[model samples]
Target: MLSESKKFRFAEDEEVTKKLFEEGDTDGDGLLTYEEALKAFSKYQRPFSREVFENYDTNHDGKLSQEEPETHSFRIINKYHFCGVFQFSNVVSLSHKQLRSISFFILAWQLLICDIMSVLVQFLLVIPQTFAGYSLYSHTFSYAIGSLDTLSYNGALMFALLLTINRLCIFLFPAIDQRVFGRPIIYGVVSLAWTLLFVFFIGLNATRCYKTFSVQGFYLHYENCENNSSSIGVIFQGIKDKWGRFSTYVMLGIYTLITIWLKFANRLHIKMNKTDGKQVRTNKKEIMFFVQSFIICITFLLESLMFDSIPRFKVYGQWRYAVNFTSNCITIFMFTVHSVVIFTFNSRIKEQLKEIFASKGKYYFASVTQTYPLQTTIVVRK
Candidate 1:
């Protein structure tokens, strides 16, 4: 006769466990012994339960009960870990939210610095013009000056787009991102993006090849050779023109669509749950953050296009300088504003930042998503 005593099963806690046992216990053995359970768990790298085996052995038997018992406290799976936080106590630990926040800041700094540096180089190139040394300026500064500005602009755009992709992963695919970038992969990607940018832009397009047709002989209008073009130079310039414009437009278009969807969805979510003021507010803020990012991305691209397109409109001399300087300042200012998007939209990030600064202890990692058990029940029957 079957004993009417207590029966236990870890299978009660999770359905998958029950299925595994049903499948693995092939000989119609109603229960898994300690060794059997250990063997099953050994198949996976996860922990096995010695306690489960003993608990199932209710009759002081060496084997488990025919029926299973529920087990509590399963392993905590998928914990987020920041690189260097564990080993380097001096460095600040970044939670997922904080990492998103800091990524925004890094992108902003890249744009701000690149725009300023490029403009400074442009300004220096023009300094010789102020002292009646136009020949000297045109001879020495012509190639290097334009090349540097183009390189800086391209480098900043490439970096910012890569960062945008990172943000997208953080918001959309947090789990996969945590699994993939949980190691030093993030640093590796950043380095690779920058190196690719340098190789494609600065290294490839260092020569002045793009020719601007200018009338050298006043009144008569005679066409003169203004630039040198090597075989590699033409290829590089062609690639830069084509790829740069295409990438800028592609990024701008994708982000604009994303922002639109987020905005509509947020509005619908808020409308459906007016009573939940916090959720509504959060949704509104998230929508705004994404919209702001989209706008900034578009503005950055448009600004670059406008600067490059200015010469085509017959705009030249001090007017160009003024436009260039003003554009540089505007881009830098926009970058600074872009840096605050994550902070403004994400309260959790603000909280983590506060904790990071306030604490004397180790840096805290914040979870982007937390799981809540909807229900739990304990049944004791004898």
Candidate 2:
């Protein structure tokens, strides 16, 4: 039942627990109100839903009294690794035509790989170093972790844009969709984009842009040029900081357009099979995939705001443990949710998962579904 939770409470310590309660208990009161707890959690970037808050406020009271902070378990990596790893594995083994025929799955597969690599490093090294204050780093560790951080964060934004564009073409501009996104073209687009992104960020490591980890702040910071705003670190950080909010707004605008297009699509005269008189429209399954992408995009929007709202609480000398736990919880959930949404929304992937596990890993049976996505064509009188 508890397999999914990454967090565990620290050992019982009244001294420390009382300090936590007092820290949360603003206005010099002994008990912490719901607002006090929420404000305190926001400072740490902790996930603070009403459900989570209610769980902490045991004893039927709406206040907290010195509860121990929660931290990551050793097995936390399993959550992301299993879902993402196996998703890729089945895709490769089965050679699923659903993914092979569509550009959306191509982008999603790349993003999944990025998430797996990012979470692997975070759970194994970053969590230990940040929370337990472990110094498990070689001289090369800085560049390596920094490269991963670059790939995951920056790579995700780019891939998400690709996915959004693919959806727009499928749902809104199907007339030029095939010419623009034929099998060879889409494959080339995603591969080249990822290659350039990888080469550019990893290439940065050759320069003076160094990423140093801070146990106090529990994140990596670039020391490429502290004083110069024109430094590599400063320049890169500025782009990342701005891209997230801008992309969110853009995606929202595009999604609105897509929604309107789909609503009025019946007004357009398009046909996949004019002989049989079948109506041409975006596939229902494709809409589900679009929904999944929407969830992830909205999540990134929230995550960006969380970071802005919760500046590093590095000054908490005695409350360092709570700070570590609360700050990392948000990150833990953020990466894990992508895979959860993927499996939950995509029926094809979910079915593939069931098949792989159902027969002890034998998966050669072909699906009876169509071998390819319907080539969207607009057949109307000029």
Candidate 3:
């Protein structure tokens, strides 16, 4: 289906492609040999296997090459593939340095989403509900907010843990990067998590929930009580004591340990890569990721620890409540900003941002160039 002028041609850097081709074809048979295959596999951060290489090389020319064995429309973002917005006709045209940068961005973006979810759930939904009665208008409002808070906090924490585990996996096993955390699995996990959250929290509330009503122009609240339920405020306090203090603290502890381990691992990674000057550029990224996690962990721990203290000392009626809310909001704000820090401080992300801008610039220049025309004018001189 190729036109005369629209033939498949190598549009990438020719020199780079030629060198890779030459190096890959080590057997002097005009094709890649098993040894060359091993080298290619090693370069891609995967273990070399002769059997796999032979199976992949369909030409039966006793040498391997970078031709597609299967006819597929979708590009695979596998170990041997880059699957970028741009394309190269040959492997040699691919820049390993740029590929690594993209890898870093992918990792950072995953972590950023988890942190954003954590902030949204913890600060906006959960923490506000911790107070005795932020939404005391009706039972429907109270139950709705309480259920949302529970779901958000727990779901966010679980998602954060998964993201941390995913980071560790990608860092250790670079070969199966796309396969390990592919789009299908990502979508499925997100859906399952949300579903579990709904069922878990909603089911719990369905059994031991309370309702508020107004009796004789006075507000009345009852929780699983048969006689004069409004007389006892113990139900609400019990709910708070169990879910607000104990459960939240448990989550905070787990997340803190995970964050600490992540920080240590990142530091150790930097130490190991001391000789690689390229890693120096990642220092800012490392610092930003570490600091953001540290802040979130500390904020969470502090907030969890202080949940009980705020109620014990009822120093200010309304003013104290305002200060408490403001402090909680600030912590949430830090967490939200933490989600975006990776994009801001990461060099790889910055590079991609520049590439996007440069691409737009090129488009505008091309448009202008096409519109303008060169003309020759005759100058009459005496």
Candidate 4:
């Protein structure tokens, strides 16, 4: 009775309806409520209404439950965003490398995961809510995301320290490194890093509080209002900041000393033996490692400085929003640049990326050629 176009449209609508129903039934209890249906359909272009929901409740029940002859698909598709894909690729590339110590790789993985979380928080929470024409603000959400950003910054610093330490050990005391920084010891250090971060998070919750304030009836703003503004809190914050800066400087000094030592060591080796291919290769690797570490350390320090300089006093109106947005944008940009530097300086990552791209290109070219066969003309003499 229906035309072809009408039949196709009906099929498409049925498919979308089934998808919405499955997504709304989060508990898989074979039922959907008003609230669940609203949340599910709100993300889509359709306007969900109470009447529409009631229509789906064919049995006259308050809830929309699965009906007879309706088959539900329970399969869910998991996909990665840009940051997630990059994080996964970075981890995979690092894993393929044959390294004497995995401490650097482990720390790098932590940093990458932190950056991805930071990006996700901004894109999913901040951007969407800002653009959705919402006046309400949540201080807790802001603080949580800020804390995650700080954790990621600290992770970068720790990574730089780890790289410097590993290089120092290899160049200065190779024998002791094996026993001192064994797999178990390295694992313990990584665990300690995460444990300390967790403790710091707890401390932030206990010491600091965030509050929302109105700005001249123009807009609502959220800012940190330290609940414990006592000398103890100040001292604790100061100690934390000082420790981070001190550790970074110490690591940089150690790296410098190692560089000087390597320079002299190379000179002596050259004098003793004119040519050693293995030594040359090792030197090149060390050079690349040093460059990468240096750049990461600088970026980490700059980010720390930026956060430290952010005014604690309440900012109002567009200025407050502008400051916050700019700072977040800069932080994300720095994180991205750091990742690119790591990939650029590491030869192993370069080779892995090359292979990946090459294979993908070959597959794409093959598919295109197959889809559109090349036309060849045959010329015959008459």
Clashes within 3 Å, all models in order: 5, 0, 0, 0
lDDT of 3 by residue, 287-359 (tens): 4544544444344455555655655764432234344444445444434443344444445646766786799
CA lDDT of every candidate = 0.48, 0.60, 0.44, 0.57
lDDT of 1 by residue, 305-343 (tens): 865785477433223334444554444443333334444
Candidate 2: give the clashing pairs: none
Candidate that scores best on lDDT: 2
In model 4, where do residues sit more than 4 Å from their true spots? 1-102, 129-137, 209-225, 229-236, 264-275, 306-330, 365-382
In model 4, the clashing pairs are none
- Across 171-192, the per-residue lDDT of candidate 4 in tens digits comes to 7877866665568787777788
Candidate 1 to truth, TM = 0.46
TM-score of each: 0.46, 0.63, 0.40, 0.60
Q: What pairs collide in candidate 1?
A: 8-68, 8-69, 9-68, 9-69, 9-70
Displacement of residue 103 (Cα, Å) in model 3 is 10
Position 79, candidate 1: lDDT? 12
- Candidate whose TM-score is highest: 2
Per-residue error (Å), model 2, residue 233: 6.1
Winner on lDDT between 3 and 4 is: 4
